[model samples]
Target: MLRISQYSSVSSQQSEQQYVPLKHVSVETFIKFFAADVTIKQVFRNDETKPIEAVYCFPIEEQAAIYSFIARIDDRELIAQLKEKNETQREYSDALEQGHGAYLLEQDEKSQDNFIINVGALPAGKECHISISYVSELDLVENGSRIRFVVPTTIAPRYNPNTGDVSSPAGTTSKYVQTAPYTIEFRCQLEPLKWLEKHPPRKGRVRQIFLLTDGEISNVNEVLDLCRSMATSTRIFSFGLGHSPSRSLVKGLARATNGCFVFIPPNTSVDIHVGEQLQKALQSYISGIQVDWNLGTTVMSTPTRIPPVYANDRLIVYALANDP
Candidate 1:
């Protein structure tokens, strides 16, 4: 499985003694060619009879270009204009102390991928929604074009190798995760590609199964076993959505079936373009692709074995040149 570091973490504590403030987070991403527009809506409610304040620390992609930020309390919405970091912090603090509801969004100074959000002075039974929007570009990769989007639902414990950095809260302890009164439900609409299901009626050829899911499956091992049994007939391609997916399960299935797995984040739009791209890729799919180098030419190439390559896929070759 590929490893990506510095992603947003959502707290998930199974213990009952922890206090969780934030309720639900809804993220919408619209992809346009190489660029994508992302919007994140965070809802927090004061379940208690008394007024309360909520603060949440999260992460955003380091390269994302954020443009809009707004806070909504009941029907009254407050648009946040860009200000100096210190000025913004002071204003938000003053608003909260005066019993007025306020919201503050800032980037973490120490870590490029970390962010902090402060939602304050929520009245009893009142709900606050904070929406943030940004735009970012997608990169072209091997095996045609691949796009990856990630949303963190759980904050994992961090291990800082550097201990001298006391200016930032890099080593501070965090709260545990528990079920909140307000539940967050995320829905993803996938345009089914029927072409993936068709298998060429020939020897040593296999059909591809694209499995798309936003949650974990209970029978992961069983599903893997089934895929192994059908290894001769079909190839399994697994896609996990959101942040808290079962990484082992998704990667295991692909590894077992000699296929590929990908995790899609909340900032990517799997719209009509996705389908068109898939169609283009499938049309260029070659069952068994091999590379041949000149024999006895004192040449060497890494990866020694080449996987299946599509027509649009870029073939990268790395070699070491020696003096004759």
Candidate 2:
């Protein structure tokens, strides 16, 4: 059995003799994280006396919590319960089977079901080599009411604040749901979502690429030129969350690449939507669509304009107000 050593081996001998084992030993394990998968590895030693542990590389606190949560129950019972829940949960309709150590969620047509939480599918037996992976449905890395996943999930991922899919502390709401690490106002966007969709992944003889904004630069043309200079085949889906001083120019670059611009306003703090859109992004590979503006109101003079269409199969409302 292996053990965690805090210090190197030590021994002392004077009129008396004393010896102690090392407290911490440095052990390095090469790791690889797939597109939307998790990997867990445990190290073991050949000692029958003490138990070895699965040392984690990051977030010792989170590892401890998962371990504690597992420690409170029966392993076989837990796995059995998890299997039953998985079969029943609608979110994990398609699953990609990998090696014994890992599996990926296949992007199937019915990829809108939520993975069952609290079941603890990724559980580790005491002192065993641990590798657990559930599904994390959302990984678009975008901000706005219409962020879609180009890749489908094996299980229904929650719109969690930590999950990067929702914009709230508890992950509520499903449509017009905007949640990024930052936010950009809708008024500051350019090109509209649909225009970008037509030219995304890359346009023309060139390949389109998505560019995320950290809200740092003041020059949109400069950013576009610099990014394109590195590779001109693709475009950038500029996400504006912080300072939108260069909003107009940013919008222009999107138009330049036949791309689009979106804003994640910092004031928003709740998730309102997430459904069929997830499938739209994954299966359709439709990064986004421009919602058509029809003045259903008394004012009929306004023509059809592409605004950020919120993707929620649950409820598809354009917006409470429209301009641009």
Mind giving the per-residue lDDT tens digits that candidate 1 earns over 1-324?
Answer: 001111111112121222445578789989876667889888766665555445566656544668998988867989988989888877875665465666777875534345667665567778878899988655344345675555444532332233342211211123323243445554322223223224332676767767776544333445455556655666666776665555545655665665665666667765533454355436645555555665546766643544444455444445654642
* Stretches > 4 Å off in candidate 2: 1-77, 80-87, 90-116, 120-131, 134-191, 196-210, 214-324
- Candidate 2 lDDT score relative to the true structure: 0.29
Q: Name the top TM-score candidate.
A: 1
lDDT of each: 0.55, 0.29
Residues 1-324, model 2: lDDT tens digits: 111211111111111111222223332222223122333333222132321111121111010112211111223322212334345333322211111111112111111111112111122332222333332222232333333322211111112212232111111111112224545333213344334445545335545444444333323344454444433455544444443323333344454554455545456431321222233323322334555456564332211332233333221323544343
Tally clashing residue pairs in candidate 1: 7
All candidates: CA RMSD (Å):
14.9, 20.7
- Angstrom error at residue 53, model 2: 29
Colliding pairs, model 1: 9-155, 10-154, 10-155, 11-155, 13-177, 149-265, 150-265
Instruction: Say which candidate scores most in lDDT.
Output: 1
TM-score for candidate 2: 0.22
TM-score of each: 0.46, 0.22
